[model samples]
Target: MAPWLQLLLLLGLLPGAAPAPNEPRAAGAQAWELASPELLEPARFALEMYNRGRAARTRAALRVVRGRVRRAGRGSLYSLKATLVEPPCNDPTVCQLPVSKKTLLCSFEVLNELGKHMLLRRDCGPVDTKITDDKSETFSSFLPLLNKDPLSQDFSVKMASIFKDFVTTYNRTYDTKEARWRMSVFANNMVRAQKIQALDRGTARYGVTKFSDLTEEEFRTIYLNPLLKEEPGKKMRLAQSIPDLPPPEWDWRSKGAVTKVKDQGMCGSCWAFSVTGNVEGQWFLKRGALLSLSEQELLDCDKVDKACLGGLPSSAYSAIRTLGGLETEDDYSYRGHLQTCSFSAVKAKVYINDSVELSQNEQKLAAWLAKKGPISVAINAFGMQFYRHGISHPLRPLCSPWLIDHAVLLVGYGNRSATPFWAIKNSWGTDWGEEGYYYLHRGSGACGVNIMASSAVVD
Candidate 1:
C-alpha cells in the first residue's frame, strides 16, 4: 500500500519474501533462486577473494544485493551483486564493515565445485545498492589502482579515498579548494611512488609515507639541500692514514660515539647536521666525551654556506674552524631559521683541528669508518624521499650519483643475507627511516654513499 513497502517488496527484503540465510534448502540438484539462502556461501567465497586482493587499509566487504546459483555439470555457478562498505577505520586487523553505509556495488561470478570455489569475474563500481547481509567486511583499496593504473576512469574516486587516509594519518587540515588540489597532487605522487617502487633494485619500500601527498617541488624545497653542488666550497685535506681491514660489522651508536637522532625541521640545513654529526663522533673518540653539537650555530655563523636555502658539509666544516668552534646544542638551541651569528667563545665546547676527506673506495671507506668514527657524506637522495626502511639501492639511472643534493653521516657497515649495506645517519628525525637512519647498498656506489666522505679532526 505504501511506497516504502513497495520498494522493500521489490528488493525481496520482506519477512517471507526470501529464504533466510539459515534456512534449509531442498535436497536436490536444482537452481537456487535469487532469494535462496544456499547462494550466500558462494557469495561469501567471492567476497573473500575480492578482499584478499586489496590492501589491508582499503580492504572492504559486502552484503548480497542480488544473487543466484544455477546447477551445472559438476558445481553451481553463482552470479551475485553485493553492496560494498568500508571498515570503521583502516585498521589492518579489521575486515568488518557496517553494510548499512551502502557504499559501492560489486558483481562477482564464483564457481563452487568439489568443496572449493573459484572467482571468475569481479567488477566493482561506486554506487549505493540495497543489500541484505548476515556479515560484511571492509571495501576499497589500491589494488584497483594497481590493475587500472593512474589513468583509470575511477582513479579520481580511488585517489580521494587514499588521500583522505593520508590526511588523517598526518593530521592535515586543508580547505575545500586546497584539499581538492592536494588530492590531485597526492594522485600524481602515488604514480611517482609506483614508478619508484617498480624501478627500485633494493628492498626499500616506496609508498604512502609522511610526505605521500607532497608534490616533488614542495618536497625538494622543504627537505633537500641543493647547494651541495652549486657551491663546491673548499676542498678538504685528504686523510693519509687508512685503517686495517674492517670487521664483519661496525656500528658507532653501539660504541656510544653517536648522539641521539635530531630533526632538522623544514630547513635545508642537512649540511650543518652532517658536519656536526661527524665532528661529534670525532670529538667523542679523540676527547672521550660524546656531545650533541649545535647545528643552529652553523646555520647562523657559517659565512661561506647559505643558511637555510642550502649549504655544503665541507663549507660548514670550514666555517666551524674559522668561527673558533661549535657551541653545544643546548647553548645555541635550534630555531630552524637564519639568525645573526651569536656564537660566544665562552660556549664553544668542541674544536676541530681540520677536516679530511676519506678514500672513495668502498672497502677503504668501510675500514676508515670502522676505525675513525662516523663519516660525513653526500647523496643524490632521489629515492630517499620515498624511503621507509630496509636497504635502499636504487639503480644509478633512477638516482644519479653525480647530482648529490643531501648530506648525511655513515655510522656503520654490515651485511644482511649477503647484501652489504652502509648504515647512514640522516637528519630527518627518528620517524623518517630506521630511527633517523638510511641503509644504502654498499660496494656498488649506490646513490653516492662513498662521495663527499670526510670527517673533522679533533686534536
Candidate 2:
C-alpha cells in the first residue's frame, strides 16, 4: 500500500475497516479525525512533548500546539482534557500550557517559555482561549473596574437586554474575543451609569444608551467637532452689566420657544443645528409660530463652513445673513451629509437680522436666556457625550474651560439643591440627556458655557 493510503487508514479515513462482532474499538479513538497529516503530525508530536513536560523547550513546538488546538476547535480540545496548567504563575510573561486536566504534574519554566513564544504569535489561539475564559469568569469585569459595588441581578438582566438591543439596532459585529470583550465593557459601563443614576443623589447623571462604548476621539469627531472653526479677526466682547436680581427659573421648551429635539447623526454639523435652533426660537418669538428651520440649508449652502467636517454657529449665522434666510425642514430637510446647495430663498421661512455674541458672565447668560429665547453657545462638551441627566457639572479634569468644541443652545437656567445650573439643549435627539437638554453648573464658566455664546435676531 502507498504511504498516503497507509496514513489515511491509520486516521480511519478510508472506511470499511470495522471491528469484529465480538471485538471492541480502542478506548479513546475518535470517529472523525483531521485529514491533513501536515497538521495532525505536528499536533501529535506537540501533545507528546506536552505530556513529557518538554513542550515549552521551543517556540516551534508551542506554535504547533496552538495551531492544532484552534483548528480542532475549543470544544474538542476541552473534551480531550486539554486545560491550562495548574497553579498559575504570578508573572505575566510566563506562559501556561493546555495540559490534560487529569494530569497533576507541571513545569513552570517550560510553561513560561511557551507563554512568551505564544505571546509573539500573530494568531495565538491559546491567548484567545485565555481571554475568553477570563471574560467568562467575570460578569463584565469592566464594571468592577469602574465601580467596586456589586451589581444586582435586575441590573445585570437589564444591562444584558440593553446590550442585546444596542447590538441589534446598530448592527454591531463582535467577530473576535477582543471585540466581544469590548462590547461587554461598554455594556458594563452602561449598567453602572444607570445604577449611579438610580441612587438619585440628584447630582449623578446617566446616559440613555451605550455612549460609553465610543472613544473620546470618536465622540469628538461625531458629536463635538462642529464648533471647531477659525474665529473672526475682530474679538467680540463677552461680558455686559446686567441687573443684580437672579433670573426666574425658566424652560423654553415649556414656553414653546424650543423646537423638537433634532439629531445630527454622524455629521459634525451641530453648528447648523445650533444656528437653526437659535433661529427657530427667535422666529417663534417673533412670528408666533415654531418652525424647524433647515440645518441642511447651512450644511449645503454655507461656503464658509466645512459641512460635516466642522463649522461654527457664528459662521452659520453669517451664511444665513448672506443667503437672505433659511428654508424650513419640510422644504430642504436634513440629509446629515455634505451635498450641493439645494437651498432656495423663495422657500425661505425665516431670516436673521443679525447675530449678537453674549458676555461671559453666567449671570448675564442666565438673564439673556430669561429675557430672550434660546441662544447658541460653544462649549467644551467632552463629558457631555456620556451625559444622561442631572446637573452636569463634570469634574474639572474631564473637561477644560478653554477647549470649546461643541455648539448647543442655552434654553434656560435654574437652581437645584442651591447649585445653579444652565439649561442647555443638545442636538443628539430626544433620547439623550434629559430629553435633549442638559443642566450644567451655572457659574464658574463650567465647560465654557459662558464663552462664545450668541443668538440670532430674526425677522
Clashing pairs in 1: 59-138, 59-139, 60-138, 60-139, 61-137, 61-138
| lDDT of candidate 2 over 1-459, digit per residue (tens) | 877556535533232222222232222322224334433433443333332321232212222122223321111221122222222233334444433222121111111111111111111124334433332333353343324336665665566556666666655654344344455566655654544344332384675454666543345555666335345412333434456555568888899998888999866788889889999999888999899888988988888776766787777888898999989999998887666788887898889887778877777777777777888887877446567677866544334566777888888888888987888888888867887787887787877777678888765
Instruction: Give per-residue CA lDDT, model 1, range 1-459, as digits (tens).
Output: 777556545543232343333333222212223465776677766555555534444445554458877864334678887776644453435435333323666777776643455565565655742333312222243334334343865766676677778877888765433454456667777776776676677788877777776656457766788777666667878897675888899999999999988999877789889999999999999989999999999988887776666788778888888989999999999987677789998889999889888888989998888888899999988867767888888767556677788999899999888888999999988878887889999999898777788888888
lDDT of 2: 0.61
Please estimate how well model 1 matches the true structure, expressed as its whole-model Cα lDDT: 0.74
Model 2 pairs in collision = 95-115, 206-388, 238-359, 238-360, 239-359
Error of 2 at 438 (Å): 1.2
Q: All candidates' TM-scores? A: 0.67, 0.62
Candidate 1 displacement at residue 253 in angstroms: 1.0
- Looking at candidate 1, the ten consecutive residues that score lowest on lDDT are 23-32
Residue 217 in candidate 1, Cα distance off native in Å:
1.1
